[model samples]
Every structure is written in structure tokens, then in C-alpha cells.
Target chain A: MSFHLGGDKRASLAEAAARVGDGALVALGGGLCARLPMALVREMVRQGRRDLHLVGSAHSIDVDLLIAAGAVGVCEESYVGFEQDLGLAPAFRRAARDGSVEVRESCCATVLAQLRAAEAGVPFLPVRGIKGTDVEGLHPEYARMTCPFTGEELVVVPPLRPDVALLHAPLGDAHGNLHLDQPFVLDERFAHASVAVVATVDRIVPTAELVGAGVVVPGHLVAAVAEVPYGAHPSSCYPGYAYDRPHLAAYLAAATAGGTALDEYLARYVHVDEDTYAKDVDPERLAAWSGSTRAWQELFR
Target chain B: MSWALDAGHAAQRSWTLDEAFVVALARTIRDTEAVFHGFASPCAQVAMHVAKRTHAPDCLLIEGATYAVDPVPVFVPPTGNDLALHRDAVYRMRFEEFFDAACRGAVDRMFLSGGQIDGYGSTNVTAIGGMPHPKIKLGGGGGGGNISASIGALTVWTSRHRAGRTLVADLDFLTDLGHRTREGSRAELGYTGGGPQWLVTELGAFDFDGDGHARLRALWPDVDVDDVAAATGFELRVALDGADGLLDPPSPAELAAVRAVDPLGVRRSEFAEVELARTPGLSGVAR
Candidate 1:
């Protein structure tokens, strides 16, 4: 009942996102400074889904890219990475200037409200804790009547119920149970808030082997599973892996340098195909490039 | 060169003239103090002023807006999001990937303020009027005030007018439930940090008692207990000995420090004026 699939197999990222429907709330999972599914997100952007609502805590290159491409209509709460990480993507800046996106504070609250709403089987949940601040005006939906006892004004936030949650896990089983050793704040909530959840993992192991591996989002919440090796590249999976800083630096350079520069760069490298991009860059060479002065300087330039 | 605390004539003084409060606030988080600040907060501006001037020359000021620490130059990208300042510093990754460090308690301290906080320290930043059907609609509360109560030590402050805005009793919406009503529930839920430690306001200071009620800790000099009582929408228990009242006014030395740090008088003057306009009666103080 929790799973649904479109007819296409090996569909593009845009096709996957299309299945989510319009005005759908989407939740993303990754590291504070990890790589996100940008290639997939690019596919979503190419599809030009304007009715999508994005909610997340921290900023990622993928989110930045989406916002740049005009894919996100509303952002509940999120932070933008430093410009160097952003590459040449100016979409976030343009959106803020145009008042297309409303930035609020606190990712946990946004995720939690959705989780509570889903758990309570309600359309939205009322929350407190932000009052007499600018956040009240930014998120007008949360402000409420003065307390009967206290006579003070309150801000109420509605719960977030996403139609689909797209997450990447380090390991999983065929049945979709996930194993993420990292300590995350809102992944559990994202799992609960979604009508269906899709998880992409690096490896597929037996369900019995995951018995004591410290599961964050349980298997039941996960709808479908896909196995993709080194899926969390750019974004580290913690104990299992680390971020590919060189590839990320190169990506940052191309993304932040301007659209023309990005096009030229991606054409020479990333855009041809995932396999071509993967084969073109030598892992050993990337590994040899230390996350040092040269790397940072190159990224900015 | 001299520090003088004058209780009787405190209100007559300007932020430029009064230095004690600035000095105390600055000195509090000088060395190795992991302080957290909220967005668009004037108090945070003052804290930054203090931190840069007094103590930790290399202080790690972690901003919610951005993650690049010191040595990272502050560049205000055109977007107005301070996080953009560090965008160049962020490595590419999936979104929501950063919570690993945050959940493991990488953050040390946080600054927070609330609307309609109750006796239980529960804050509501939700809708006003009513739940399903409300007379007045409000912006959705963000973050649910969880970060404020979850951090190691939370310094809560507000600059709102006391009369019609503040709460006298329990809140209509619950943003953050400060100290849980029952003792065992918090630990049972896997949260290990203490609740809010301090509540500060333009009028006075408050702290939660062992029994889980806010107790008045201090009042601003030149502010009468009646003024505070009238301004507060709720009935509050005053200190028995009146020891919590402002006895020693803010000293000139403190004022000098504030002036020296904020040479343009940004925190005390224009900023205060902007905040005062939002809350009535404070306009006189601003002028």
C-alpha cells in the first residue's frame, strides 16, 4: 500500500519527480556538507515542475541547483551554502531578490510539523515556540491567538505531509529496510510524513544482517529500494565513505562560474552521460588532489 | 576610565552613556564560549560586538545562516542570506546531509526567543484566534522552537512591548515545550541536554525555578515593579527581598566599551529605534 511505481524503468530524474504529482511536498536527506543527487535533480529541473514545494533543513548543491532552475515554489526553512560551494548558480539570489522564495528558520521544526501531521492523520499540526520575531511574519500560518491563560500571542505551524520522500542510504536489503549509521535529526520524520518513501542504497544485504546495525528510518516506512554503487559520492556516508572533494571542487567550479561556463564545463565532462563522466575522471588523480589551497583557489577561480 | 552604577538616573542615560550591560554581555561569552545566534537578532549583533572586542580573538561564531568558521571572510552575497557568505566554502552534497554532526551535539550554545511562552516554558508561534478557523492568520512557526530548548545552554531574549503582546499565562500554541512536565519523559525520548537556562527581555530577566516556573531574576533600572507588572499581561511572582531589582545601574565603563565596539552606535541607536517601533511605549526610550 505504501509503494507506487510509474511504468518506466531506468527513468530519468524528471520522470521520477513527475510521478510525485503537482503541489507535492518533497523531503531530501543528505549530509550538512555532503553531495546530493544533482544529476537526478537536474533531470527534475529539465522537466520544469513548477508546482513542487521543497522542504529541507540544510542547503545542498542539488537544492541550490533546483532553486536556480526555478523548480522550487516555496521553501519552508533552509540555509544556502557559501558561494564557493554554490558555484555559479545565482538562482537562489535571484529568487530572494524577486520574492519568489520565502526563507525561514529551523529545518527540524518544518520536518517535525509534517511528521506530526502525518502521524496524527491531520492536514496540519499547530506548533508553538516562535513568537515576537520576524519568523512570525515570514511564516504567517504559524501565528495564533493569544493563550487563554497567558494572553500572549502564539505562532502555530502546520505539519508537513509530503507525497513522496527521496532518500539515499548507505546500505539496505531487497525489502527496502535501510541502515544509516550517521546521526541525523530529521530523517525519521521525513520517513513518517511521506505517503511513500524511496531509498537508493550503495549495497544490498540480507535483512538478517541489518538486525543490530542501528536503523534510523525503519524498513516499513521505505516503499521501494534501488541499488547504486558509490551513490553518495560528493556527499559522504560517514564511516562507510567520505566526500569526493576533487570531483565536488570541479563541480563547484563549473556550477558557480556562470551558465555559459557551466555548460562548457559540463559538456566537456559531466553532461555527456553519467557513465562517460564517471569514466573520464580518474579516482586516483582525484584522490591525490588534497583539499588544500590549490583546490579551493581553483574552485573560486 | 571609571565605572559607575547609578540606579536612580538609569533611564535618563543613553546606550552611548550606559556601558555596563554591553560589557557584561560581551564578557559572558569571550573565551571558548560556543555561542549561537539567531537570524536578524540585534542582541546577537551586540554579542558579536562583545566577542570581537573583549575575549576570544579567534572565537568560533557558528551562524545558523552559514557554516564557514573564522578565516572565512564575511562576504554579503546579493541574496541577503548570510548563509550565502559561506556558499563558496560549502562542498557539494545532498541536502539534509549536515544533521549528522548537529545530532551528535556538535553545537555548543544557542540564542533563542519565543512568542507566547508559558509557565512550562512552552512557546507558541502558530496561528492566532483559533486552530481550524482563526480571526487572525499568522506565518507558520518555523523550527518549532526545538533548537532553543535542545542546545546545551540557551540564552533567550526578547525586545517586544510588554502591554498587549506578551503572555500572562499558558500559550495557545506550543512551539517549544521548555522543561517537560514529567521528569522521565525527556530521557526516555533520548534527549540529554537541559532546557532553557535564561530568559532575558528589555524590561527584566527571568529564570526557570526547580519547580519549572519562570522566576523574575532582574529588572532594568528606572523601571518600576508596577510598570513591569502592568506591562506583563500575566500576574508574576516577584522576588521576596526585591534583590532581583536593578540596584546598580549600568556603569559608564560598560557604556564606553559599547561605544568603542559600536563606534557608529549601530546597536544602541538605529537598531533599538527599529525594535522599539514594533513595541509601543518603547518609542519614548528609542527617542
Candidate 2:
């Protein structure tokens, strides 16, 4: 692991995206459709980062968009579909099938175990299950040993140290102290385990305000931070805004249509400036979602 | 896919096929147990809600995405991660803490499904064909591999089991621990939890026998033994008592509980288009 003790760790979205080099192993910080760091992801796409290896527990558009942009070559995630909402991720499915991407399938428990091992500075950690299933055979890094105390056989996974972790949050300080929201899927673990963390936040507050809000990630653990409002546009940064269902539907339509349609979508959204993308997504309308319970419910309708 | 508008609680005559199937799913839950449902499982989510509102009120319900414990959401949202699902949650579980509890055999039951579920109870959510490149890359099993080894029981369901490629004779890849697998039996593998207890499908329900194979236990209305046998890829095994295996239709109370818990009819999305057309009030609902 690495530490950033600098007094100010803030950077532009492009600079934060540059912190993740080409062919680097990236730890995606959120799960499903919430706080997925999409602004930074779009910037990375525009910069043409290539051969990224993505590691996560569960994800959707963030990972799919990278693959669709031809930036990802290896996927180590346990799950990559859109859950019950939109069904499977079309680009990921196609890439995995056509042999464009390597699928090192993992489970949530093993991924957590690997990250915990890295966090503890251990070489490996034993996981409770995964034996007798084909998943065990797929991971050559996994080994079997007898428990010294109980003489029971167990599977142990090696520690995974990603090159950089991408995270999005509701609040963070210029120094990199972050107040992550709940359902903190694997963001805390990813922050602690990765070598460096590059993040985007809806707003960057003072260190005092951040500490008052309860800091989940301390300043020293983060490499860089970019204050980009509505950073997780298509995805939800809860208490800030709900996921843009219509935008996601349009994206799915374009991606499902084929390469040309997807490229046109990228040209219209990804290659644009942050302010333009925000305006196109209608920030005022998205901000109004949290005005009331009824408004929030109507967002999904 | 737009869900049919709720229409603000229109009158209905009979329960739809999805409601009947959800009641069958709820029957598998014990009154006192810790049950977990994963994301993308609308039927299981509705079943858990129905069971809690009706029979299994004390069951420790866990939301898949939010990880909230004992949440009393007004209705199940289309997406699992919304704060709507976390409304009135007694406690929110962290990702690591819940898995740690499952490793200690704390989770009593979990809901699981697959692209292919074999007679031995093994499931394949990993892929459809060979490894290096699969014919179809299914959504990989999120935590089923470890949870299946530690949880007390598993309730397997598949809506596409009606002559679809669901109940296969062999799985291309075994993604979860079952009664027995390519490596060995669960006892040999030292699995702490009992494997799949029931396999509920659109056609019928199955219970594992002493030999650890799926045996027919109940049939849905209008589904005969021949129909199930024709759809099944493996040789069918029936319970010792033949005619008694027919599943009883959902009672009025059970139907009312399902409707109350799922006012938006979110569970109807689990069915195919042909099946959705069979729904009572929301007939011809397009997905």
C-alpha cells in the first residue's frame, strides 16, 4: 500500500484520470448503480486508457462502459450485470463470448478475502467455502491446506493489490479525507488495499466538515481527489441524486444497437466537457429528485 | 422494460401464475430462520416479503443490495440498492460482516437460481459452454459459491424452467456447492450447510431424495407429470405418494398478502411474456 501525506491532494478530473496509467489494475469502488465514479470513468475513456484490468465485487455501467470503449482487457469481477433492472450487461457479455476479454471469474467472498489479506499485509487468507465447485479450479492462485487447529481442509486466496482504485462519494476534503455514504459496498476495503486511490466527489468540503460527517477514508490513504458535482450522473450518488433511468435506458439502447450507435453515444456524452455532460443530463431536474418522497418515487416511474 | 402501471389497485378475480409461484416459494421459508435474497431475484424478494407478512414474521430478512436487516419497505423496488428498500431498517449489515456470519453458518437459507440447474442440485451461473470462451457468459455467481457451503439451506428457483434449457442433465460449469459435485459429496467436501432443499420452477417443485437427486414433490395447476417429464432433461423421480404431490392453490389470505406486499406487481417481471399475458388484471402487460 501507498500513502499520500501531501497537504493538498486535489486535482482536475483529467489529472485524476491520468493517475490510473494504461495497463493498470483498477479497483472499482461501488456496486450496481450507485456512486460509480462515472465522470472520472468518462474522462479515462476520452484519454484512451487501454488494457485495464477491473476488479470488483459487483458492478454495472461503469465496467460495461469501459469495455465498450475498448479500454478493458481483463475482468476479475464476481458479477457485472445490471441486476434485476436491465438484465445482463450487453458489452461485457459480448466481449467475454468473443474472447476479447479474459474472464477470471471470482466470488464475493473470495474477493473480500483477497482484499482483507492485502489490508492486513498478509500473503494469503483462508476462505470458508469454494471447495468442490468449479470456481476453485479456475483460480490457480488459490491453494488448499489443513487447518492447524481443527485439521479441516480449506481454500486460501492470495492477496490482491490493485494498482489504483477509482471511487466516487458525496463528500471529501481537499486533503483526501472522505465521508463515504452507507451501503459502502467495498469502497473502504478497496481504498485500504490498493496502492493508490483516485476519487471524484459531488462536493469537496473542509476537513472540519468532513470529520464532523464521519470520515470513512483518511487523507493519507488517497492519492488524488477531484471535486466534480454530479460525478456519478447515470448512477446515483444518493442524497445527492437518484440514478438517471432515462439516460441509462438510452445508453442501453445505443450499446445494444451495435458499435456505431455506441460510438455515437460516446461522441455525444463521453468526449464532452463535464459541464456540458451535466447540462445534457439536466442537473436541475436530477437535483429536484430529493425534494420529497413523492419526487424520489416519481424518478423511477 | 416498463412495468405495467399499478393502475392504483384495480380489482382482480384470481391470483396470477407469478403470485402462485411466489406463495410456493414462501412455503419453503421456516418461521424462524435467517433468509437472504440476492440482486436480480424479484420472485425471491417478493416471496421473502410475503412470508414475513404472513407466516415467517420472525424470519431475519436481509436485503441483497442495501444489506439492511429486517427492513419493512412499502414495496420492493425494481432496483435493489435504492434507499426505498432500506426504509425502517432495524440494522444495515456491511458486506464483510454478513459474509462472516454466513461463514459461521449463521444464514439459515438463501435464494439461488441459475442458467442450468442439474439433478444433483449443482448450478451454473458462470457460463453456458466451455471455459476459455463460453457460448454465453451468464452473470457470474456473486456469493453463491461460499454461501452455498455455509448456509443452512438453499431455495433454488427458475422461471424459465418450462421446456427451457434450465433443468439440464449436466451443467457446463458448477458455480455453487450442491448435494454432490464433480469433486465429491458435500460431506466429503466438508460443507457446513445443507445443500439445496427445494427446487421451485414455473412447472413444479422438487425435493432432494436420500440419494441427493431432485425428486418431484409438487406440480402446479394445469401441469401434469408428462409435461414436467417432457421439459426435464434428466430422468424424473416422483415422491412415494404420487397424487398427493400436487400443490394446493394459494389461499385467499396468501394471495392478499402477496398483493399487499407487492402493490406494484414487481414480481410479475420474472415471468416470460406469454406468462405475463396469463396474469389476471394486468393481462397483455408488455415487458
Candidate 3:
């Protein structure tokens, strides 16, 4: 596939989210509740695009916000929940409970298998194990095949090529080369499997200065790179900041209260611009959390 | 590299339910084993790191961060699973590679938890009460649901277990299907190995006995037999000879070790932890 930036790759978060267009199957990076593209996610909600499909193996805040905003129409994920630490996600829980959302619950393997198939440009990926589990019957539209070599039944997942891949990285260049200190965690696969990828980073550095550290998402696959500092706030960006626990706690508190409380939170946080949204949080605490984390994360150097 | 600090303050505090749970979970980890922590697993992450630093120094610890640093740091994320938790790990592994290891049975043990757990070791991390659409929809089978069917053993860390919420007569959904894929079908699906080798809860610890039913192996010090039995909806199998086998409380050394990695009290956050502990540092790396 030929890679094109449509022009200059450096764009705003709004511009990157706008490039995704409407009704696109979006793939979010990060596992559980880390490294999510919260800036872009909030932008999608701010723009009010409905009838969208989400594809990712593990998700937390990114999926929850999308579900709460009533923007996601379908989701193909391993599972969507705040880890044991944060309890259950309220907006997503309520939406799924009411049947307004269509969720395809999978073991993490199936989701990875689908992404691998898409990255390989294949129709299906044959995976071992999970043939006898509920993964068999979850998606009737999907099928299971017999492995030709061993004649053993294998779970075959359909290719899940996303229209756009949105993720947050620790560092990136103006040309869209991303440097993430952490493991790929399915972000590289998403970049390969998606038609276009939008990355939000802590900073856009000079390409010449991005030495020693390897580029995780190559510039060619990236459609745009937005230098949005604290882009993954409320979520952690390795080598940069940690998740805002107090902020997440407040959001959870509001979400659990249900109804108007969630709306009030979105109005103050998600609906506002990056600057105003960030102001809602104490700048000192955010700096300290990220500051304490830098030494441990930067040991890669 | 950041220098190690004194872990003195954290040691003096009493071990809470979450801390005891961490020690119990850590004991299950054997040396020279490969372990993985799945989604939303804070308690499990702490246990793996604790064991890696102490008893099982050679154990292969894997998580999303793909961290591979020598002499791991006490990198704790305030929220859920983060790469920082895997700080000082000496290798970078992708999810696909981990999946390959799982399918090949290269993994020895893993940590798992769900919205619901039954007496037979089947867990429901998916929806509750109904299907397609349900009364409650929690996060569905992360890696655990598949790990139950693929991995060799599971160490479930459940912080809270109420009658209707967790311990139940029947699971609302079977996200993780171990040897007991169905209630009566034990490893009939060709998947072998005992399921839920160590099932640790807030009240006690359990293991699947010979007949594939949950056997109560140990209980927390504070709780009595009635307290545990009443909290459970199903008939629990207690260890014979009247020895409740109370879990060994976290030694000062264990607390110091826990404080080293978790100086911020992330573990304590499960039940309202404080940032700065004033107590003596029973830990090795004093605060």
C-alpha cells in the first residue's frame, strides 16, 4: 500500500481526528488504561461523529469515553473494563447493559489474530487454542477452520483492517516517526493494519536528535503527527507522564453517579480545548506524577 | 540510574487486606518460571514484581511495557496496568510473541481475575445476568479468558468478593474456561493442567482439589471459618484436620520490599492508602 500524508504530516489533534472522517472503524492503542490517545478521543466526541466501529484488543478510558459519548456503534475488543484497581467503567457498562452498543467479546488472542491477519493482508488467521471456548460462537458471521497440517480445529478470525489508527506516543518527529520506550503493545500492528494512522505525542523532536532510540511507528504509515503534550492524560505516556489517578477517580465518581454528572464532566473536561481541559487539573500534581515516573522509564537510555 | 532509598517509613504500618493478598499471591510464584500479567491487574503486577525481586529472581516477568532493565525499579502506576510495572525487565516482547508462547505452552503461570467466579474454577469477565445484552456489562475476557484455556496455571487475585457479585452458584458468563469448560466437563476439550492453582480472595486462599472442585487451602488471620463460609454462596472444601492454615502475615522484610516498589501506596489505594507512611521501614529498600 502506498503511504501518503495528504500534505504536511504535522497537524493538530482536531485535524488528525477530522481526517478519520465519519463511520470509520477506529483502532485505539494501549493496553487496559495506558498510552491511550485521549486528546483525539475527546476530539471525536467533541465533533459528534456517530455510527463508528472500534477495533482493539484491550482498551479502558478510550473505549469508555467513546461509548459514553454515544459515538461508538460497534466494538471488536478482547474486553473493555477498568482494571481491578479502578473497578468497572460506568458509561460503557450502562450502554452495553441497555443494548445500545454491539460488543464482540473476545479472548485477547482473537483480537490479536484479527490484527495479524490484517497486517499480513490475509483474509483469515488460523490460531491454536480457543476453538472449544465461547470464542467459537461469539461471532457467527466469523468462522472456524480446520488446520490442514494437523487436521486440528483452529479459530479463524476475519481480517480487522481499521480505517484509522489513533494512539499516543512518548516522542515523535515532524515527519511522523514515533519513538516509544515501552513495548509495542499492539501499536505497531495497528499502524500496519490501518488504512491511516494518527499519532499524538508529548513532543515533536528534530529527526537528527532522535538517535539511539528506535522508531516504533515509521513515518510512512502515519497520516499525521500532532504534538499534543499531555495527550494521554488520565492515561500514562511512558517516559513522559503517569495516569492522573485523582482525575480518573473523579471521572469514575461522576460516571458512577450516572446521568447528569457524566454530562457535567464532559462539558468541563472533554468539551473544552486542551489548555482549558488541562487547567481543570493541578499542573503541579501532573508534573510530579510524570516527574517521578521519568527516572524509572528513562532507564532505557 | 536512580539510587535506592530508605524504605523505613512504610514498614511500621500494619499490613492491610490488599498487602496480605499480595504476599499470598507472591508465594504461588515459583522460581525460574515465566509469568504474565493481563489487563487491569494492579495486585497481580505488584505480586510478580515482589517475587521477582525476592524469591524468584530468575523468573521471566512480562507485561505491556516490554521492559527489560536489570535491577528493576519500583515503577508503580497509580491507575491500572502500565509498562512501568514491568520496569527493569530485561527483554522486550510483543503481544503476538506472547500469544505464540501461550499457544506453544511456553508460559508456566499467569494472573487472572473476573467479575464472577464459580466453585468449579470457571470465571465470567464478560456480561452478567444475560447475553448479547445483559443487566450488567463488565470488561470481557482480557488475556485471562483465553489464558485459562491455554496457559498451564492461573493465580486469581480478587480484592473483593461479595455473595452476588463474585462468589456465586453459577457464573453469568464463562470468559475463562479452564479444565472445567462446562460444569461437568473437566478438561474434556483436550486442554490439560489444573485450573486456578491458587485462587486468592479477600477472605481466604483456595485451590482446585483432586475432584476439580475448589478446596479451601488457607484463610486470612482475622477472618474465622463462619465468616468465610457465610460470605461464599457455594459449599467450600476446607482443609482437613481443623488446621485453617492462616496465611503468613507480611514480614517487615516483605513490607520493606513492597514499599520499595510501591512508595506511592498504589496497593493501598485499593482500600484507601496514604502517600506517605509514617511507620518503621520493615522493608529491605528503606523509604
Whole-model Cα lDDT of every candidate shown, in order: 0.50, 0.85, 0.71
Give the Cα-based TM-score of candidate 1 against the true structure.
0.51
lDDT tens readout by residue for model 2, A31-88: 8888898998999999999999999888889989999999998999988887767878
Q: Which stretches of candidate 1 lie over 4 Å from their true place?
A: A1-18, A35-39, A46-50, A83-89, A99-107, A123-126, A147-152, A245-253, A265-272, A280-301, B1-287
C-alpha positional error of residue B174 in candidate 2 after TM-score superposition, expressed in Å = 1.2
TM-score, candidate 2, is: 0.94
Error of 3 at A212 (Å): 5.0
Which wins on DockQ, candidate 2 or candidate 3? 2
Q: How close is candidate 3 to the true structure, as a TM-score?
A: 0.86
Candidate 1, residue A40: Cα displacement in angstroms equals 3.5
Which residue pairs in candidate 2 have backbone atoms (N, alpha carbon, C) closer than 3 angstroms, thus clashing? Answer: none
In candidate 1, how many Å is residue B38 off? Answer: 8.2
Best by TM-score: 2
Q: Candidate 3's residue-wise lDDT over B77-131, tens digit each? A: 6544555555556666677788778766788888877777778777777888846
lDDT of 1 by residue, A132-229 (tens): 33344456556466557765444556766777777777677766777864334356667777887766666677778766675666767765666655
Once fitted onto the true fold, the runs of candidate 2 whose alpha carbons sit more than 4 angstroms away are: A287-294, B1-13, B240-247, B279-287
